[model samples]
Target: MKLDRKNLLWEGSRMFLPEHRRALLQQRKNATKLAVPKIDEQQLETMTYILQEAIEYEQPVLATYVTTYEVTCFCGFVDKVNQMEKYIQLSNGSQTEKIPFYLLVDVTWP
Candidate 1:
C-alpha cells in the first residue's frame, strides 16, 4: 500500500469489525441520551394538582416524563396514585402505563 496519509493508518485493517461497530453504535446512542430536567416545588405542586384533577373529574391529561434515554409524552387519564411505591398509573383507552413520580417532567390538561 502507498504511504499516503489517508491509507497509511488503515492499510490492512477491518475498519468495520463487529466489536468496533457495536462499540461505535453504543457511543452514538449514549450521545443522544437526555438529562432529566429539574422540577421546582411549585411545578411539582402543579403537576400533583393536575393528576388529582384528572383522577377526580375523569379527564385526560398530557403528561411528559423522562427516562435515561428519552423524554416521553403520554396522553391518558390518571387511574391510580401509589404514594408508597412512588408511581402513578395512567390509562388511555386500552392500555395503562405506570410512571414513577420522580420521572415526571410536566402535566397539562388536554
Candidate 2:
C-alpha cells in the first residue's frame, strides 16, 4: 500500500510508526529521572575533606558519580568547592564541570 504523503507530512510519520514512538518514549522516560544514591553523614564528610585537600593542594582526582543510567567517572583537578552552594567544580584542561554533592559516590585522590 502506498502511504499518503499529505498524512505523512502533516502527522510526521509518528502516527503510522507506533513502535518507533513507543521506543522513543521509553528512552525518554528512562533518561528523564536519575536514581541518585544515598550518602550518609560520614561518607559525605570524608568526600568533602578529600575534595578540600585536593582543591587546596591543586591536585587532580578521579571521582565517580551516579547518573540516570550509569556510574560516570571523571578525572580532573578539583578547582573549587562551595559548601554553601553544595557543588564542586572540576577542570580537565579543556572544560569544567560543576557536580553536585549528592551525585558524588567516590573520590580517589593522590
Candidate 3:
C-alpha cells in the first residue's frame, strides 16, 4: 500500500487487513508524540527584541521556531524547528512595528 503526499492511503484501502489498520493507528500516535520547547512571556519579549535588532541591521534572524497555539484540534504537537526571517515595518501614525516571525518558539542569533 502506498500513502500519497496528501496522506491518502490508496491502492488497498478497501481491503485493508486488521493488522494494517493497527499499524496505521500506531503511526498516527507516533506522529502526535512530537514535542516542542515551551515559550514563556519573557521569551516572547526577548524574541521580539532580537527580531527588532535583526530588522534594524537588515539581517536574517535564524531560529528554531515552534507554534505558540494550536490551529487544529488534532495538531497536538507544536510546530517543528525551522528557520525564519524577521523585519520591521512602519505602521500607522509613524510607529515602527517589529514584525517578528510568527510561530517562532526558539532562536539562536548569530
Candidate 4:
C-alpha cells in the first residue's frame, strides 16, 4: 500500500513573515491618523481670550486640541500660562497637561 502526498496540500505549515506583519500594522496606523486643521487669526484670538478668561475667573472649561494622529478633548481648569513657551497648563483634579498654543482647536466654558 502506498500513501499519496499530492492530496496533502492543506497540511503544509503556515508561515507569516515579520516584514509583512510590520507593513500591515503600518497601514492600520496610517488609516486612523488625522490631518492637522487650519486655525484662522480670529479663531486663534478667540481661543486665547477664552483661555485667559477661564484662568482669571477660576472657571472650568472644555478645550479641544489636535495632534498629528488624533484630536483630544480636555475638561479642566486653566492652571497657568507660560507666555515665553506659548503653552498653557491645564489641571483636571488628578493631573496636569501642557498644551501648546498651536495645538489649540477650540475653547468653551461648560
* Model 4 spans with C-alpha error above 4 angstroms: 1-14
Position 80, candidate 2: lDDT = 78
Candidate 2 residue 17 C-alpha distance from true site, Å: 1.9
The lDDT of each candidate is 0.89, 0.83, 0.49, 0.86
Better of 1 and 2 by lDDT: 1
- TM-scores vs. true structure, each candidate: 0.83, 0.69, 0.40, 0.80
**What residue runs in model 3 are displaced by over 4 Å at the alpha carbon?**
1-32, 35-37, 67-102
Worst 10 residues of 1 by lDDT: 7-16
Residues 1-110 of candidate 3 have per-residue lDDT tens digits of: 76466545464556878998999998887776644556888987886676566656655444554433332111111122224554323223333233334534554364
Report the number of the highest-TM-score candidate.
Answer: 1
RMSD of 2: 6.6
**How well does candidate 1 match the true structure in TM-score terms?**
0.83
For model 3, give the RMSD to the true fold: 14.0
Residue-level lDDT for 67 in candidate 4:
77
Highest-scoring model, lDDT: 1
Model 1 lDDT at residue 11: 71
For model 2, residues 1-110, the per-residue Cα lDDT tens digits are 98878766877535557888799989898877768888888887887788888877888988889877778888899887788998888889997888888889988784
- For residues 1-110, what per-residue lDDT tens digits would candidate 1 score against the true structure? 65677866777785578998899999999999988788999999998888888888899999899988988999998888999999989999998989988899999997
Worst 10 residues of 4 by lDDT: 7-16
Please report how far candidate 4 places residue 87 from its true position, in Å. 1.0
Angstrom error of the Cα, residue 53, model 4: value is 1.1
